[model samples]
Target: MKHGFKQRLFIVAGILLVVCAAVWLVISAISDNMRYFVSPSEIQAGIAPEGHTLRVGGLVVAGSVRRIAKGLTVRFEVTDNASTIPVVYTGILPDLFREGQGVVATGKLRADGIFVAGEVLAKHDENYMPREVQEALNKAEGAVDVGNAMRKSAGGSL
Candidate 1:
């Protein structure tokens, strides 16, 4: 009976090891595919990963959108109002994409501080903005308010 118990223990340990290995593999795979969402201010603060793909959400700066190379490759600046990041996308933008609209671009940041976007997603409706973009804008506005309050307390002009 002791020998049988030892055999059962070994089997249980082996099963547990396999389960752990499988879980580890799944977690690693998911982590590798995960793309973090960040704002223009965060990008300006150097919070974005240099080479890893991530999502940036903010308003497309008015008059900053430009078409290059026959209008296929486009460049624009995305802003959280407090900060802006230049973005280059080499494909046709969404139909709703326009200046002063909310946009989320997925890509990696180039060494020259430009965001090379693989995909550009724009807000669908006039009243609808992406949640990430809205959150980023709100955070930037809050920062501006705090800055203004500090300046006022220090007797500085607005």
Candidate 2:
């Protein structure tokens, strides 16, 4: 009876250990694979990871958007008033995607610094701005006097 009880206890402990290990692995995986979105200036300032997948958003640079092969593939540049990143997308772009419109793309950066976008998302209107970009712009425009240098550009207020 003592031997049987000891064996059952050992089996339970082993199962518990396995479960704990599995949970830990799952949590680690989720944390590692989670990606975030950033703007062009953020990328230029070295705020984003070099090799991880991320979303980049900005206005489609004026006169820089071109359609290739009946709207199947499009090439454009997203500019955040400071820097621009070239983007290539092989899927149907959102209807709001156009010259000087806001856009967001998700993908990894290529060796040549171009963004190879897997998905292209666009905003509905000219006034559309990401929350982070809006705040950055407001602060940069001296809407708040925080000692940060004000930056103004032709592509938009921010």
Candidate 3:
């Protein structure tokens, strides 16, 4: 009876260890794949992880979009009123991807200060701004409060 009990205990211990290991592996994998959102100001302040896939969102700077030599590649600058980051994308832009609009780009930042975007997300619905981008822009410019900004952009009274 003693021998049987000891064997059972050992089996239970092994099972528990395997379960713990699996959980740890899952958590680590999720963390490695997760992408964080940051504003242009945060990136300029060195808060974003360099060369790691992350999201930077802000308003597209007016008259900053430039076509690169008649190719699909285009360069533009995004700003949160406090700081700006140059972005390069080689694909067709969304119809709503115009100047002074909120935009989010997912990619890694280059050492030369250019954000090489793998994907660019533009405002979809009418008078819609991503919550994160709107908050960041509001924070950057105190004179332009959140309500005022939204109203001004939407061309409606708040």
Candidate 4:
């Protein structure tokens, strides 16, 4: 009976070890592949990691879109009202892509500070906007509102 109990305990221990290792591996893999969703303001603030995959959302700055002389490459700027980020993309843009509209781009930021997008997504309709872009705009507007309120309370101009 003692020998049988010892064998069962070892077997259970081995199984537990395998489970733990598997969990660890899954966590590691997820962390490695995770991409951050951020705003152009955050990128301008120097918090977003450069050369790492990131999803940035904001409005396409008016008149910022330009096609390259050669190739399908296009360059534009996305803004969160407070800051703007230049983006470079090499593929076809979405049909809804245009200035003064919401956009979300996924890619890495080069050391030169331009976002090199692997994919660019645009808002589908006039009334619809990407959640991230809306959030970023809301956050910016909130900040501006607070600033105005503070100035008023402090007897300063808006």
Candidate 5:
């Protein structure tokens, strides 16, 4: 009876260990591969990991978009008022994508600060403002308020 009980205990412990390992594997796979969206200034501020993938959204800078080799490769710039980020994509862009319009790109940041896009998404309408652009504007407004406070403290006039 003692030997049988010991064998059963070992079996239960082994099953629990395998279950734990499987759960860990699933969680790691889900979290490590997921990507988040950011903006041009956020990239400039170093908010993302250099080697990891992410999405960025902003307006395509006017006259900064160009097509090459029969549309096999395209280059463009995404910008908020604070800054702009150059992007390169090798795939066909969405029809709605154009200069002075909102766009979202999925990719990783290269060492030189350009967004190496794997996918390009364009805004669907004129009334659309990309989420990245909205966030950047909020941040900029906050900075302006802080600057105003400092200037007021110094007795400066606008």
Candidate 6:
């Protein structure tokens, strides 16, 4: 009876070890696939990791969209009013993509400071903007307000 109990315990331990390893592998795979959202200002300040997939949200800079080939390859600039990042995408852009519209691009930042986008998403409705883009804009506006206040206190132009 003692030998039988020891064998059963060893079997259970082996099963538990396999289960734990499987769970760990699944969690690591999911985390590796996850992408983070960032603003153009954050990217410019070196807050976003290079070579890691990330999403960037901002308004499409006016007069910046240009097609480089007969295919769907295009390039443009996304800006948060304070900072701008150039993006290149090879896929067909959304129907709503246009100048001055809000956009989100998911991809990796290259060494040359340009975002190589895997997907480009544009605002679908005229009055709607991505939540990330809205938050970034608000932050930029607040910063501008603070700067103006500081200038006024220093006896500078409003």
Judged by TM-score, which candidate is best? 6
Candidate 2, residues 24-84, lDDT tens digits: the string is: 9999999877878777776766777778888887667777877787867888888765677
Which sections of candidate 4 miss by over 4 Å? Answer: 1-10, 141-158
Stretches of model 5 off by over 4 angstroms after superposition: 141-158
- Report lDDT (Cα) of residue 123, candidate 3: 80
- Judge candidate 3 against the unseen true structure and give its global Cα lDDT, from 0 to 1: 0.83
Decide which is better by lDDT, 5 or 6.
6
Q: Give the per-residue lDDT digits (tens) of candidate 3, residues 43-152.
A: 88888899689988887776789999988999999888788899999999998887767799999999888999989999886467788888788778443654454445
* TM-score for candidate 2: 0.72
Candidate 6 accuracy as lDDT = 0.82
Would you list the C-alpha lDDT of every candidate in the order shown? 0.83, 0.71, 0.83, 0.81, 0.76, 0.82
Candidate 1 lDDT over residue span 111-145, tens digit each: 88999999999878656767777777778955433
Using TM-score as the measure, name the better of candidate 3 and candidate 4. 3
Model 1 root mean square deviation, Cα atoms: 7.8
lDDT of 2: 0.71
- Estimate candidate 3's RMSD in Å: 3.9
Question: How well does model 4 score by local distance difference test?
Answer: 0.81
5 versus 6: better TM-score goes to: 6
Runs in model 1 lying further than 4 Å from the true structure: 1-17, 141-158
lDDT of 4 by residue, 1-158 (tens): 99999999999999999999999999999987898989988988899998779999877776688999979999999877778899999999999787776789999999888999999998776567667777777787443332332234334522
Clash count list over all predictions: 0, 0, 0, 0, 0, 0
Candidate 5: tens digits of C-alpha lDDT, residues 65-116: 8888675789998866567899999987899877766678999899999889
Comparing 2 and 6 by lDDT, which wins?
A: 6
Expressed as tens digits, the lDDT of each residue in 43-129 for candidate 6 is 999999988999998777767899996988999998777898999999889998877767899999998999999999987875676
